[model samples]
Target: MRLLLISNSTMAGEEYLDYPKNNIKDFLGDKPVKALFIPYAGVTVSFDEYEAKVKAKFNEVGHDIVSIHHFEDPVKAVEEAEAIVVGGGSTWNMLHLVHKNNLTEAIRKRVISENVPYIGWSAGSNLACPTIKTTNDMPIIDPLGFDALNLIPFQINPHYLDKNPDGHGGETREDRINEFMVVNTDMYVAGLREGSMFLVENGKINLIGKLNCRIFKNNVQAYELSPKDDFNFLLK
Candidate 1:
């Protein structure tokens, strides 16, 4: 999959269009962009206004925008799309909606078959894992199924190392991911610092950002990165 996976909304050294979008802009490089911003829990914007805003973003980037919602025809959406950007939300909820709308396969086909790039940030990144069972957020309700798109074999716990004054929480993001690693022995974890991203070029995974990245195997620190490099080990 030509996936642009970002850790969070903040881009590297900038606060404009979120981390993932920055990666996308680089990969697209003047190519037309069409996005599908998966809706929030109870948003009330009409389709026309949504389309207008989408058009605006595309126009700002000199791309085209084709607006589609979870409630609409996903097949048509994927077909018309040259590139797709999935926004952040509840992982369980978004996966359920994807399955409910029978969009998982169609989206995969678009990315894998049609060669369209798929950009996901936050919960969108979570959905690209093999399964969503290990996410830090409580799965409020069981989805149609928790199976991920499996774009990448490994699981990514984005937004790692949040700085908080009070250190009290049920479990740290790393802790939760460790719990999953204990059971799933094969998958590697990429601890993406905020503003960092995983870029898929020619079906290879590479690290892009201005920060160091940590690699985890069975929750143990494997290595750290400060230089710009492509992670072929993860791809293998």
Candidate 2:
């Protein structure tokens, strides 16, 4: 299986997808691919607008994408897609639509069994995990099920922050993750900081970008891992 799970789409003071455009280009290779884009997570923006923005970025990198909403049979679209790209927004709405369209299994089979390259950021990245329990978004709508694509064995907390803002008397991100660990003791959760991402291909996993990823597991102290360190252990 091949996956490019990004922590977030944009960095502060940067254009949308500006930081990862080259990474996306490199991952797609010299050959241009017209990947099928999943824009279900979008709520505030229309699918046409979302696809246009993403299409512009991919076009800048010599690739292109067509949103799945344009297709009548979404499953067939997934089956015939050369690559799949999922954009970030509301994970709840995304999963709700995905389940409503019966796309979970089709996507799973396409990426896991057929070796299609899968790229996702933020909420899209969350869908790559075993469940969306690690998402930072509020539960605005029912996701129908907590389960996600399960493309990766571990969970990813995207846009992970080290501390809460000043004067905020709420649980820190770590505290919430600690609560999650109490029940899901067997799973591993990676606090994927902004501007960071994980690359998984051919049974090996690597961390990208400068920021270190914070790892959490039950009974073990949460730790930081730099890009130079081996992340393949998380695959197990």
Best by lDDT: 2
What does the lDDT come to for candidate 2? 0.97
Give all candidates' CA lDDT scores.
0.69, 0.97
TM-score of 1: 0.83
What's each prediction's TM-score?
0.83, 0.99
- lDDT tens string, model 2, 29-77? 9999999999999999999999999999999999999999999999999
Off by over 4 Å in 2: none
Pairs of colliding residues, candidate 2? none
Task: Write down the TM-score for model 2.
Answer: 0.99
Residue pairs that clash (backbone atoms under 3 angstroms), model 1? none
For model 2, what is the alpha-carbon lDDT of residue 58? 100
Candidate 1 lDDT, 57-163, residue by residue in tens = 54666665555564357767777777776655577777877788787888888888888778777777877778876555657656789797878888787877744
